[model samples]
Every structure is written in structure tokens, then in C-alpha cells.
Target: METPSTSTSSYQRDDGPVRATLVGIGLTVFGLLMANVLTTPAFLFDPALLEGLGNGSIAGRTLALILNFVGMFLAGLLYLLATGRGLAWIDLRIPSRRDWKYIVAGGVGSLVFLFAFNIVTTLLEVSAAESQIMEIIGGDQTMILIMIVVVFLFNAPAEEFLFRNVIQKRLYAAFTRMQAVVVASVIFALVHFPMYVAFADSLLSTLASLTVMFGGALIFGYVYAKTDNLLVPTAAHAVLNAFQFTVLYLAIEYGIEEVQAEPATLAEVADAVWTVAVALA
Candidate 1:
């Protein structure tokens, strides 16, 4: 029987619920600060250095993304060492046959949650805010391609490693599984507030955006709790993101939806892609 990659904890945690929660939060903050610091150089960034990276035109963007991911990765590694844990403490493994069932459910469940959330928001007359990540991608074929790769390699793995394996796991020391999932989800949702706030029309919109993010966190958290393999949620998150970019690319590329609007429909997105394929063929 093969086990996931993990290490036995040298276990010295003495903090109570409140203090322990704070520790997890501090790690999140540290990661963000470090990522920002690492990415700052991209502001005056010249693309010439990595001119032929992901795409020549998006060289600077690619560099910034790499730095940002590196910063977050380093933060997690440093914290792991500081806590007397090793790299192996982060649990990752190949998905077993049963694990794939949960992974697929996680991805499909997320989409369903999103659909239901959109309906509720509309029913409540809550105006939605533009997603910062989507706005950045903005239906650009090149940017979307870059993001598809980054989301799989860096974004999903780094975020899941920190929030799920590190933060959520730490909370288990002082809280129940449900409590830990909720707390970690709250942190996950709140961290996205800055991005949402920028495009928010009002407080309601910001809150709405956070609600969706919170729900997403919950979905991802639920999968981690069920599977216990960090790679499961990472794969689920990355697949959802990849599907979104592909759908969104088709939606906007064919004028089926505007760049700034939420995708109108998946059926339409697929239809557009088929149309293009046939035309090209």
C-alpha cells in the first residue's frame, strides 16, 4: 500500500483556538506580503530579459506571476521549517481510483455552487462585482493561456498547500473539522476582498463577491476534508480554472459575450468553439 507524502509531526503546538487561528492567519499574511514584495519589480519590469518566455508580448506578466508564486512557495517552506516540520509534511499523492470520483465531484460541485450562487444573488437583487482575476485575463487569448498554465502549476498548488494543508490542518489542533474548514474558508474568502473591492460598485457587491469566494473556499475545503490528499483539491481547483479559461476564451473570442461580462452560458461557449473549429477545418 502506498501512502501520501507526509512526515510525522514533532508536535509542540500549545496555542488555544484563538491564538492558533491567529498563527494560521499570520502565515497567510506573510505569504501575501512576500508575494507582493517579490512581484513589485514587475512594475518597472522590462520584458526584454525574458522576451521569449510564455509569450513574448506577455513576458513581463509572466515574470511577475513567477515571482509571485515563488514568494508564496518560499513563505510556506520557511514557515514549515520554523514550525519544525519538513517539506514532507505537506501531503501530496497520486489520486487513487476512488479519489478521482471525489475530484470530479469537487469540480462539478463547484460549478453548481457558482450557478446557484448567481441565482441567489440575482434573486436578492445583489449586483455582482467583476472578478479581478477574470478581469486581468480579460478574454485575451494569450493571457488566458498563461493563466491556464500558472493556475495549474503555481496558483492552485501554492494556495491549496497553504490554506488547506497548512492553515486548515493547524486549526485541527484546536478546532473541529467543520470549524477548521469554516475558519480557513473565511480567511480564503477575505484574502480575495482586495481584488473584489477594486471593481465593486457598492458594499453589497463586495460582500457578494466575498460570498462567492467563501462558497468556493467551502467547496475546496470540503473536498480536502473528504479526500485528505492535498493533491485532490489542487487538481479539482486547477481543472475548474482551466475549464473556465477555455469556456471564457470561446465565449469572448467569438463575440458571444463581452470581455467584461460573466459568461452568458456554457452551451453558447461550446457552440462558439464548435463553430470556430468547423470554420477552421
Candidate 2:
């Protein structure tokens, strides 16, 4: 119901957006680098010791997911320490009833945005990066289950802690709430672009994927701002991601492939643009 205590005796009010931006950007870059190194198939497994752990294998995916989770958490913790803040600043407590409302709103908002984005992209003949991600999910039911758990428990919290709690909160000291929200959301969306680029066959598809991400990040930022609870946004994020993976799992199980979009007529493209504008409004 109330905002968490962000106060600290060691916290410096003068350390504003400049410090926040540097620390946020630095930790993100560092975390990605560490994740890549830690998840490298050659580094994690010896060819002779683990001949079956190829880059595309379930073992590799699991390892990479786990390592990436660890790397992000470590990076966040380090950022907190470096900034003279503590875990208390992150507001990782149980959500209050009001917080739950915000969480549900955030989750539903995300789903709505997702459906709208999907419709627009489908009309525009944009292929989804999710197809490639689903391929990585593969047909292994057990691995898929494990992935859902990891994403819900680890990835969601870790990302929310870093972006919303640390980065956005710090940015608040230097900018208006809306400005902080936009900047933080932009960073959040931009960081995910590499994955889309890796999977998308064309730049247009990658941009479309990033557009959806940006919209989702905007909603997440808005929720955190409104509720002032990290757990709310984190829970919402977890729910959204888990639901997505769940749908993917069911699709894979039932052999329902992603729908390929037909080439858009000029009118369809204009209509799709109008729809997006209306949705944004």
C-alpha cells in the first residue's frame, strides 16, 4: 500500500542521473559480457568430457539460462554496493493487496499490448522472433518446464531489480518521472534487441520485435512508477513471460506452428499503422 523505504544513511542525493546512467550501462554491458563468457559452450563444457553438449542442445540452453541469471543478479548486487545502497532499496518484500492489483493490471496490460502488437505485425507481414526462440525451446517437455521455472523465478526478478529498482529509481533523482521511465524503458528494450537480431531474418522483423519490447517495457515502467513496488512489476513481468512460454509450450505440444503473415496490401499497412496509433493513444 505504501512505498518501500529507499533511504540510506550512506546514500547521496547529489549522485543523480549521471551516476545512474553510467552504473546502469556499465553493469548491463558487464553482465552481458559475463553471461556470454560463462555460457560459452567451450568454456562450460569440454568436448571430450561432454561430447553431447552442443550449442543447440537442452543442456547448453539450461546452462546459458542459469549462468545468465546468476550474472545479472551479481551485476545488480555489485551496482547496489557501488552506489552505497542496499537490498532494502529494492523493495523485495511481499506485495500488499493494492500492490497485487497493480501487478494484475500490469500483467493484463502486457498481454493486451502483446496481442495488439501481434495483430499489427501479422497485418504488416512481419515475422516474429519468437519462432526462433521456440525452436530453441525444442520438444523436450522436462526442459521446457525447467525453463518456465527459471524464467519466472530468476530472470524476471533479476531484470526488474536491475532496470526498475536500480536504474529507474536512480534516474528519478536526475529527471522527471516520465523522463526516467522513457529512458529506462528504452534501455530495457534496446538490450533485448540482440536476441531478436539473432533470430530475425530481416531488419524490419527485428525492429518490429523491439517495438513490442519497448511497449512492454513502457508498461512495466509505468507500473513500477505507479505502485512504487519492485515486486509488483517483477511479478507482472514473470507472469507475462511465463504465460508466453506456456503458450509456446502448448503450441509445440499440439504442433501449432506460428502463423506466417501474408504480404500486406497498401490499405492493410495503413490500417495497421492507424491501429497502432489508436492503441498508443
- The TM-score leader among the candidates is 1
* Model 2 vs. true fold: TM: 0.80
lDDT of 1 by residue, 1-281 (tens): 11432222332345599987898889999999989888767645764434323333466777777788778877888898898877766777778887898899988888777667666765788766766555455457788788889989998888888898888877877777678889999999899788778777899888877887787788888888766788888998898778767766665566654433654222122333445455445
lDDT of residue 131 for candidate 1: 63
TM-score of each candidate? 0.83, 0.80
Rate residue 59 of model 1 by lDDT: 65
lDDT of 1: 0.73
